[model samples]
Target: MMSNQNSVQSGFLPIPSIRRTVSPSQALSRSLATALVLALLIFVLGPLVVLVLWAFAGEWFYPSLIPQKFSLSWWSTVLSDSHFGHSVLLSFIFAPVVTILSACICLPAAYAFSRYQFPGRRAMFIGIFATNAFPKMGLYIAIAGILYATHLMDTFWGVIVIQLMNTVVVMTWIPAAAFSAVPKSLEEAARDVGAGPFRTFWHVTLPMARPGIIVAMIQAFLASFDEAQGTFLVGAPNYITMPVQMYSMVTNYPQQAAAVYSILLSMPSLILLLLIRKYIVGGYLAAGFRMK
Candidate 1:
């Protein structure tokens, strides 16, 4: 024992060195993963790269690696267009309104789903998401007749209500998970100090769940802003949002206008994503199921 202790003190302990070989299946999986990553990058980014090139191309024909010429003329033309400006204004106006209204309706419903065990709760939850399970275009076609009968077609509120359906499920579902992650102990602690139910929930539970709520609202805003089918079906030829404008430009073969509109439609959501990236980690989301 003394000699062993002396050997250990002298840093002479025998530690086995193990060299592991990669199995054939592991090697194949690694190769496939690399290929899949490269494929996905090209698939997603290829169109975006082409869009930027087309936006600046003065006159690039086929069979060319790069544009023959490039200019800022398209930018000037798109910026000066009054119709594009109107669509931009309408998108900015309605997306937030839809988000706010959705959030208001979702908040209480989310709380109930999170904290309660009422009858038909599971069915209602499943049914809410079932609306999103089907094809949205078919749903929009059905809703169009209702909008016409209700005299809501081609109106601002009509367009908003159409947009609202796209966001309602997402807003409620995300925030319900968020609210579920909040500790009941924290609410009880707040109440122990004399806070009422409303006060405790407002001061304690809400602040804890705020990050998720913000994320949900941002997603809701983006959904409403980018919803093409419903907005186009309900509000087109009268109230055109940015996504509908992009659709029209693409259909009309105005490549530069389409590219510029695409950029305008995408930039805000990208900026918001960058700003809230820290709150969007998988661990934060997984906390919904990690009940204390």
Candidate 2:
């Protein structure tokens, strides 16, 4: 009986040893994962962090691990400059207009694409996606010619129009996913409750799609705000944008220009992103849940 008990005890002893062995392996995996994530974060964000530091640094060129001094002189200089002020004002005005226009143009198309089985729908989507594959620079000549012909060249409207073309595709794709998440049964229930198409859309559909719409707006706004090539191509000489102004200043006043303009330009998108991050995450989760 003592031998039998000893055998059972010995068998149970390995269990703890097995657990101890597995724990290290699991810990190693978790450690590796954490290390990988940290590495990636540093890799991606290191440059931006450096840029921000450089912007604030009083003087930085070579052989400097850190700045000797820090001051707001750059900010003061850029803000006081008329050219920077004009460019910032122009960007602030143009970005929202482009976003709104893109949303207006895309919403209907997105609705049709998501809810209906129209002819050549997939093909049409493919075509739209193909546009992104092409180098946008290739189309600049054509765009410039059209803008010149329409007498919109070197105007704010020209930049808006150019941004609109790209924004619509993004805005539509985002909303279409949101729209598709709305159950057919819900629409039928609204109809059964004596709700017309517009009423159902306004009351039921729009609320559910709000997150996606916000995300689309954020995307469109960022696209419009950061647009350099198209704006430069179209609005050169006559109208100056923030990016254009930044480019011009880079040669003469790299530090001050990068410091002030980069912060100013990045602030809106960063604020917007922070504001809607939760909604964007929730929308994506809701989309996945609806799909299942």
Candidate 3:
């Protein structure tokens, strides 16, 4: 017995004592923090777990924590739906088109915000930000009224305009901060060496800001891609995008089909986020206030 104990003790590291010198307050704080994190995990991930189960469940019922059987029929049904392909096409078209348009409009605004000092500059920035900071349902309703007047209702441009609204704030703010971070001296040095203002900006300033711009573009794409509420209000009958299709599936289709569809809707945004995960850091975002 002594030999076995000695061998085991020598082979493996010793375990620490269960008793610790931690203060009562510290112990309470640690326990509270752990509980909070656990709660947050449940809040965020619990539905996802349920959704994933429902997507594959063959005969799940009440009073059960798991399915009786699992199959790929849910996925097959979701994939086979005629509207599925159309919804995906609409999402792809809308997200990228809106992203491109947003980049064109907001990038120049971002550059101006970073480089120029004009009247109402801060106010303009605030106004742009306030569009997103406040509740959007009201804005969508108001915009719907205007669209009705302009005969833009149920039109492609109308839907594009709505999705574009969500992208504006992130697209402008991040790139503005990025452009502000580019050293003025480098741009000046390029100009001094015979580069024109535009050339200098292209070569020196823009490349340095590419990371933040990439991050912004990804955000804009996701925002437009995931947008369902406004799209539903305007484009329901004619232009049902993927997210909007999810809304329809929730009420009209089987819960399992909806689960399968939800995961499909989420794939592009998840893939994009994972691809650009490194660039979506807080460093560039924190530079927003540094923009003058």
Count of residue pairs whose backbone atoms collide, per candidate: 0, 0, 0
Q: For model 2, how does the per-residue alpha-carbon lDDT over 1-292 read when each residue is reduced to its tens digit?
A: 9888766776889777577669999999999999999999999998788778877878776788777788777888778989887888888888888888888788888788788898989787666665566678777768899899999998878878887877866777778888887888898999999999999999998888778877888888888888888888998886677877778877778675676678787888889889988977776534522211
lDDT of 3 by residue, 136-200 (tens): 89899999999999988888999999999999988999999899889999988998899999999
TM-score for candidate 1, please give it. Answer: 0.86
Pick the lDDT winner.
3
lDDT measured at residue 199 in model 3 versus the true structure, 0 to 100: 95
Q: Write down the RMSD of all candidates, one decimal each.
A: 6.3, 4.1, 6.0
Worst 10 residues of 3 by lDDT: 13-22
Query: Which stretches of model 1 miss by more than 4 angstroms?
Result: 1-33, 283-292
- Residue 153 lDDT, candidate 2, scale 0-100: 92
Per-residue lDDT of candidate 1, residues 140-218 (tens digit): 8888999999999999999998999988777887788888889899998999999999999889999988988887788
lDDT of 2 at 135: 76
What value does the lDDT take at residue 249 in candidate 2?
Answer: 79
lDDT of each: 0.83, 0.79, 0.89
